[model samples]
Target: MKVQRHKCMNERCSYDQQERIPFATGSCSYTHRLARYVIDLLKAMGLKDVSGLMDVSWDTIKDIHVRYLERHYSPPSLEGVDCIGIDEFAVKKGHVYKTIVVDLRTGRILYVGNGKGADSLDGFWKMVRKKGVKIKYVATGCMERTGCK
Candidate 1:
């Protein structure tokens, strides 16, 4: 049986090959980076056994995922908005918390920030201001504990 290779995952870049190519920095082609993300996500979701899961190396998976995150999630600049809604939630099981801000009119969560504080809310406001988005009214839940308003 012949093995199948995947294409590169660098967003609209596709160059697949049966043999690996080394770049000037001694790195494999972009296709390998894409393969690594799939491998890493699978491993993270408890598919690391590799026999039934297709014999992928852990190091490869980790490298790809890290690269993917660095490329994809590097926070973008927010601009031109109106009416933001703020809400907080406990994302993880134990102690982790996060705040999600959304545009009320458009109903899109503009950004997620750390902590459930006025500072976090302030950060979100700053982002909007930086983007030249006007803030009309903020729809938010009660700040019972920290005296946030």
Candidate 2:
């Protein structure tokens, strides 16, 4: 897509601007339709495969996926949450750990944190306190080890 560049012919004030493409976002090379197609392909394929098929870089495919996620899934609200389940799972060969907090009633994930144990939930606890969520029941994978109630 070629965008026409407009230049001011005035010698005293020389200003130049390019016409914006209707199908693409500001400064992005890919069109909106292409991005949507890539996202659809990603649902069935991995990042590397999608990038190869689309003839785009792996990082570009990742960036498109991340932007799509950010636009669609903004974090769920913690309001009216009484029962919550907390669990820690290994991400890679039991080395990298990730903590996930979920609302028992709706089964919606509230927070995700890096690492495990009590320290992983510090930010979640702060958010719960700040939001004034009165959590009544708590279910955890390791209650004794994590000191969770």
Candidate 3:
């Protein structure tokens, strides 16, 4: 269907012929409903794994997820967090180590990192400084570095 557009009075305007459509879509190619549906299934289906089921390219599914996150998600604020807990846990009996930082007040996982050491919490430290979060108490467990640094 052709859209009848009107031209601007100014000859210098680049977009002189502009058409307004009530059914125009946003920058995202997918419709709002389809995008939401993809996001809903994304958690369980996954982008790479869902490409076959959705019959779309892996990159397309990945882009859809990126757009979904950009529109709906924001990093949680660490402001007002006074207490935190950091611990290193072994996966498969010492083959892998992961460090996790949690908010003591709300019990939310703030940061996760591979390899346990002082540097494991570096990501959290940087975010804390940027967010101006003051830590009054910290409970750490099993800080032994297993040479995974």
Highest TM-score against the true fold, candidate = 3
lDDT of 3 at 98: 92
Of the two candidates 1 and 3, the one with more favorable TM-score, higher being better, is: 3
Query: What is residue 81's positional error in candidate 1, in angstroms?
Result: 1.7
* lDDT of the structure predicted as candidate 1: 0.63
With a 3 Å backbone cut-off (N, CA, C), the pairs that clash in candidate 1 are 79-131
The full ranking of all candidates by TM-score, starting with the best, is: 3, 2, 1
Instruction: Kindly provide the TM-score of model 3 when superposed on the true structure, using C-alpha atoms.
Output: 0.69
Model 3, global lDDT: 0.75
Query: Which candidate would rank higher by TM-score, 1 or 2?
Result: 2
Steric collisions counted per model:
1, 0, 0
TM per prediction: 0.49, 0.58, 0.69
How high a TM-score does candidate 2 get? Answer: 0.58
The Cα RMSD in angstroms, rounded to one decimal, for candidate 3 relative to the true structure is 4.8
lDDT of 3 by residue, 35-87 (tens): 67788888887687788887888887888888778776666678778998888
lDDT of 2: 0.88
lDDT of 1 by residue, 1-149 (tens): 24357779788887875533542123443365456547565655743553245565666555556666787677654555657677888867738778887877777777887877766566766766567776777777846522345
Candidate 2 Cα errors over 4 Å, as ranges? 2-22, 87-100, 112-117, 129-149
